[model samples]
Target: MVYRLLKYVVLGPLLRLLWPTKVTGTENIPAEGGAIIASNHLAVADSFFMPVYVPRRVTFPAKQEYFTTPGLKGRLQKWFFTASGQFPIDRSGASAAQAALDTGVRLLAEGRLLGIYPEGTRSPDGRLYKGKTGVARIALEAQVPVIPVAMIGTDRVNPIGSKMWWPRRLEIRFGEPLDFSRYAGLAGDRFVERSIADEIMYALMELSGQEYVDVYAAKAKEELGEAVPLHGRAGEVGAARAGTAPSRVPESRAG
Candidate 1:
């Protein structure tokens, strides 16, 4: 009820009117089923705009801090996230990634739509990054189809570190569902899992029309952050690899 109220009566109308979003290929979404919607993480708005356009409720794994913080401000934030279709997940501890993967699989097993960013974080420079294999693991474990969705121009609407949204054109494109039933029992095989993740990223690249970066976005951002203070601002660096590239070889072309 809260999610519906916010999506239709509250934030949905306001966001659509302000951003002027255009969604395409929504028919690719299954009417009802356990599925994973793998999207290219461009901005925080990607989460907001996606659920507003889709017919079904989308649940994302948000860091626990978003719901557990103290004070009135924290309570408001918690309410908004829950209303916007997000659930808290603890991201601490050595097994955090695996724990999150298990949570996603559980949601899928229960016949819910799960939204995940394969890149694990927002693109540092709007280029698609190499995807983490957790998405593949979840799909295999839950035996669900993975749908690739692309969010275009959301960066302008909600840029990194920006306090206010700048009205801009937005688009969400959905691609055909990817079937990994062939790899059903091979969930824990690292090589097979990486292959699945690479395929998913390749699909995202075609749908999103963005250049594929073979490096992880978080590492790329860390390198950018470290170099920006000394040489120039982040924009000037523009996804500086800073020697993080070429360390690991990719098994497949993510593009």
Candidate 2:
């Protein structure tokens, strides 16, 4: 498949060479079952790196704009993501969220890995933001485990304002899976969902060692008046405006 071949041939070799990575708790990833890998978004490189290191093909819901471009560039962008096992999610409207969740649930039902960033977007600072309830809803509804993953040092390689790369060492740590079966019957309750989301964020906080903030990505994006574009130049601009640059993120070895 494209995911395997690309990882082994292109991205994997480059990652191993340019910025040697150290991974922990990779075994925490379920070998053969549906699970949600919830991670904190720190940088643009976060998206590419997470998929590269995971053993199974983990699909993330990307904005539909990545798929619907105006020309050949858009076509290739769409192809790349589709081939990489990522599906498009319209990050707009109430209907879009429902549709996105439906796609994720279906993938889980088929025993596939569904990777999501509950914060919804990369944190301007390296702090773990309050997660949206969508991730919790997905887990509880699908009866799946949510694996907390914390990524460090990606912001250095391709931080907010850079077109080029830097040779920063990257580390990805996968935390133990959190089972939500205990809250299955309470899936539809917003209060319960938000509580579960908070719990997941706490796990990420412990894993990544970043300060926690009680704000969702969408709200943060709005408060900053940032207009996110599809990809390429527009994406770079948005990233820069949003302060996605590398920072002295505080992290320590897990005890």
Candidate 3:
């Protein structure tokens, strides 16, 4: 299969040789069965390095644009994404978030490992940001555990707005799987969902040892610009002044 060929023969070996990644707490990953790997997105390479380091095949929902380009390069991009276990996600319309949640639920129901960046977008300044509740909704709906993964030093490999990649030693630490069965049927409760998302983000913060920002990463990028302040409190106040609140689960029904 193309997946195996790419992982074992081509990309995998190349990544290992270039980055020489060090992974710890991998035993936290289930040998088999469905689970969610919730990670703090640091750089574009986070996605690439994650699948390369994780033993099991991990799939993440990618924007449809990654598959819809109109040339030979686009075709190669589509092939690479597919072989790497990524699937196209149409993130448009009012139900875009729900659509992604539905896809994640389906993947988990089929016993596949789903990779999610709870922050929804990469941190503009390498700090942990508030997580969206969609991750909690999918985990509860699929009745699976959420594993916290932290990718360290990936930002140096591929920083924001940079097309070139630099070889750097990357560290991936997998935390113990978080079980939220206590809120099993309460996915509809906004408070409970926020709590679940907060819990996951907290775990990521501890694992990654990055400063935690209460506002969403995209908002921080937009309002605070790429040079996010080093002080967490200042950034939070600026985001608050900019009218950015913590992310919540979409009210739309998970299809």
Candidate 4:
């Protein structure tokens, strides 16, 4: 298949020779069966490094625009994404969230490793943002464990607004699987979903050692502009601009 050819014959060798990625906790990944790899969204390269390092073929639901761009370069982009095992998803309208959940659930039910960015979008300032509850819903629905992953230094390699990649040493850390079986059959409860999502984000924070932001990454990007203040200070400023009272976010409800 194209995925194997690209990984073993082309992209794999080039990425390893150029970026020099270091990965830990490969044993934590399930050798078989279904699971979700929930990770923080730091940069576009997060997607690239995650799949390359994992032994299993990981599939991510990329935005449809990545596949629908016009011209020759667009076609190549589409081909590369497809070869890399990414599929397109329509991330528009009110049903967009549900659509993504459905896609992930279907993949999990088919016994594949699904990579999901719980933040919904890339972090504007490299700080880990609050996760959306869709990841929790998928895990609960599929009855699979959520494995937290952290991509370190990917933002520096392929920074936002930069078309060129600066090859640098990067890392992929896989944390132990998190089981939410205690909350089984409770996916419909919004409070339970939020708690589960927040728990996954907390694990990502510990693994990545990034400052946690309680607001969603997209909302922070809109209110705080493209450049969010680094560290944990952006939350207060963003909350003020968005007219929400800033409070200490609990670990179990950070999302």
Question: Candidate 3, residue 75: CA error in Å?
Answer: 1.3
lDDT of 1 by residue, 190-211 (tens): 9878888888888888888887
Better of 2 and 3 by TM-score: 3
lDDT for each residue of candidate 4 in 123-234, tens digit (9 for 90 to 100) = 8888778788889899999999999999999989987778889978999999999988877787888888877887888888889988776788888788767654445355
The worst-scoring run of ten residues by lDDT in candidate 1 lies at 242-251
lDDT of each: 0.83, 0.78, 0.83, 0.84
Q: TM-score of each candidate? A: 0.89, 0.86, 0.89, 0.89
Candidate 4 lDDT at 81 equals 91
Clash count list over all predictions: 0, 0, 0, 0
- Report the alpha-carbon TM-score of model 1 versus the true structure: 0.89
lDDT per residue as tens, model 3, 91-169: 7775887888889999999889999999888887777788888898998899899999999999889877678999888
Q: What tens-digit string does per-residue lDDT give for candidate 2 at 1-255?
A: 777777889877777788888999999999998999999897878878888889888888998999999799999999888877789999779999999988898999999999999988887545566778899889978999999999998867876556788888889999999877767677787877777787788788888887665555555556554433223233222343332222221223111
**Model 2 residue 20 CA deviation in Å:** 0.8
What clash pairs does model 4 have? none
